[model samples]
Target: MSQVLSVNVGAGADKPYAKVRLTGIDKRPADGPVAVRAPGPKRGVSGVAGDFIGDERHHGGDRQAVYAFQREDLDRWQGELGRDLPNGCFGENLTTVGIDLEQVLVGERWTVGDPADGEALELEVTDPRIPCRTFSGFLAERGWVKRFTADARPGTYLSVVRPGQVRAGDEVRRTFVPDHDVTIGLLFRATTTQRELLPRLLVARDYLDAETRSLVERRETFTLDDA
Candidate 1:
């Protein structure tokens, strides 16, 4: 059975772009259950109510509202780095156990608890998170972003279906699985260094986030123009 191991959130603060100083990336697990609601277009359309997103242009939105990572993956990284990897270390709101997020298809839906409340707290898997300079700086490791990307374990992003409270140890179940080949890892590779797979993203056109859809369309057009 899959469940949330941690529920984490953070507040916004000033940070020197060149130096790390309390950025939201260092999220700590919530002391208890935390309220999570979609901040709709009127309210930044990205993070939940209590969370802070440092970059407006790249972070947060309907498609990237919540970030989730596999706790088991973190454990492995901890061993590799000889460090303590706490929940939300990578800024994920929910750290899950027994969930294989890598192969999750775009548009797959998950309910964290009571189908009723979870109906609102429902989360639809969207895209793979692309780590940024902020992440690299936060970890204080050289080529952190490159290393993470190369590992191809970038966690998945999710869109809120129903807004409600989420806490650690909530039951997690896959409510729906879309019929598509755009798994989180596949999509991540397609968008990043794998140019060969860009054209394949069109298979899940309607379900893909706008940015990715646009990328596929543009890539297709470019391919045709050259042919």
Candidate 2:
């Protein structure tokens, strides 16, 4: 029962780095062709390249930019950035439309692309991206960090299954499936406030990042051997 909300493309669509923005309901029970290729393992790829199951971005400290925006903040997101930066700040390639992106938990699956392909590809939610100072500073917003983490609206990270041109207005159909049946809120709480509830957060380990894992590991170690 997914629906298309709004379709927004860049004003400079013909430009070399035109941004594509889509805002609307992600179609349900939709599938499109996905052509995934290995971007590389953390850093750079030297050998064979083809569709890959997973790819890491920071492993080799290689920075690959993409679109990013929380679901609820879309109303004035563009304006906000424009006002803040005056010359455009955030580099989010696409701005989601109708979906309350914050609600999408980790491990959720999405099928993106034209319907003619018949469920052509799948993308999985892997981790939460904690924005760094550069991003925050770019917007010149002081409380942006607190607001982002507090909202826990960590936009979903995609494990691209099919690669193709994703333009504005393209429907993004989402399927909720938690590997450990836990929510992102629970994990965020377990790590920050409810340290005692760390075990519960383990349910969604597959969605955790290295920093989160390390925190959990440290907590576990402390619990196992108290000196």
User: What C-alpha lDDT values do all the predictions have?
Assistant: 0.81, 0.45
Candidate with the greatest TM-score versus the true structure: 1
- Alpha-carbon RMSD of each model: 2.3, 8.7
CA deviation > 4 Å runs, candidate 2: 1-38, 43-68, 76-89, 118-121, 185-197, 224-227
* TM-score, structure 2 vs. true: 0.60
lDDT per residue, candidate 1, 14-34, as tens digits? 666523343567688887767
- Model 1 worst lDDT run, 10 consecutive residues: 40-49
The CA-based lDDT of model 2 is what?
Answer: 0.45
* Model 2: per-residue Cα lDDT over 1-227, one tens digit each: 33223222222112221111221111111123213332433542211112111123331111222223443464455465555321113333334656555566656766655667764444555544555544454356777767656756555444545444443356777755665655545655566556788766566665676677777778778877985
TM-scores for all predictions = 0.91, 0.60
Off by over 4 Å in 1: 17-22, 42-46, 116-120, 224-227
